[model samples]
Target chain A: QQPVQSPQAVILREGEDAVINCSSSKALYSVHWYRQKHGEAPVFLMILLKGGEQKGHEKISASFNEKKQQSSLYLTASQLSYSGTYFCGTVTTSGTYKYIFGTGTRLKVLA
Target chain B: NAGVTQTPKFRILKIGQSMTLQCTQDMNHNYMYWYRQDPGMGLKLIYYSVGAGITDKGEVPNGYNVSRSTTEDFPLRLELAAPSQTSVYFCASSYRIMPFINSGGGSDIQYFGAGTRLSVL
Candidate 1:
């Protein structure tokens, strides 16, 4: 099953902070995050394993909650470059070879 | 070092027509996946393969078929195309490195193609 992401859309001013959440009904083995700009393929951000480790890339960080089967991406000091659609892909405990992406969250960072 | 390459960046197909979206990866990754993204929506998996000669269906696999004849190529075929199938298609591959870490093959970081935009009239 596909993961569910919160905040369908959000607008932020420069330097503002925002959080996007992704929750799955199945047991999550790992969570992957990516950002997609207009007319561009999705770019990898970071991956968090089920060990509850928080992974970070630049000002963007993500936390995985194994118990809750959820993950959250945190963006601090947002930049115009951060404006794009954020997606969370989940690898379930079922050992599926494919990563199921979430519903997606559109984030726009204005200058 | 081209990560992933997709041919026919943009295409328009008439109803009931068929076409194949070609995807090739030079990274020689063992895993490949096909997904479709509608405007303002998240990606939906169409099919995936673990390696050559292995394929499986994903969340939304209807109206689509795939074959992984070689490790470098995984093509998605759309038959009897409909307007609902018109969307941006992406092909991705992952190495699935560090198997000893997370029991489930650790982490998989997927490298994506530029994507093909298809419109069915």
Candidate 2:
């Protein structure tokens, strides 16, 4: 089953912030985030494990809510380089070793 | 080492044609998967193999077939192409456990290739 993502698209100016959310009906052992620019493969970002913790690098941070079976990605002080479609891959708790992807959130950063 | 390699970065075909998308991995991972991305839908799994000689169907397996002859190769076959099968295809490989590769918490991350863009007329 695929996870559901909200705010199909978002646009922001430089230095602005944005959020992309992903929710799944099944509990997840981990949540992985990837970003895809036009005509390119998705690049890995970070993964949040089941501890309901947060992991980040620079201006990007993500939270995994074990109880709610949801994850939220926060992009702070957005930059032009942040323009791309973000996708979330969820590893279910069933131990299937399979990943279910969200529809994706297209983020466009303007000057 | 090259993590994963997919051939034919771009291709076009007429309806009823048949073709195969080739994928090979150097990491010696035990799992390989093929997925397709349509316009507004999330990536759909076409097929997956855990190890050599074992294949399984995924969410969307219609018009497609997969074979894992050896640990290094996993190929997806499209029989009688249709416009509906025209989309971007990606090949990925991962270990059963993250950090499953060699790094931290077993984050077993998946390395993707520059996807193949297929258009069927």
RMSD per candidate (Å) reads 2.1, 2.4
Q: For each candidate, report its DockQ versus the true two-chain complex.
A: 0.67, 0.59
Candidate 1 global CA lDDT score: 0.90
Q: Which digits, one per residue and each the tens of the lDDT, describe model 2 over residues B2-117?
A: 88999989999999999999999998888889999876556788998988999999999999999999999998999999999999999998777444322344445677878899
lDDT of each: 0.90, 0.87
TM-score of chain B of 1: 0.92
At residue A35, candidate 2 shows an lDDT of 93
What are the clashing pairs of model 2? B98-B106, B98-B107, B98-B108, B99-B106, B99-B107, B99-B108
Number of the top lDDT candidate: 1
**TM-score for predicted model 1 compared with the true structure:** 0.92
TM-score of 2: 0.93
Which 10-residue span in candidate 2 chain A carries the lowest summed lDDT?
Answer: A91-100
What lDDT tens digits, residue by residue, belong to model 1 across residues B1-121? Answer: 9899999899999999999999999987888999898987788888999889999988899999999989999999999999999899999998765452444433477899999999999
lDDT of candidate 2 at residue B118, scale 0 to 100: 98
Q: Which stretches of candidate 2 lie over 4 Å from their true place?
A: B98-104
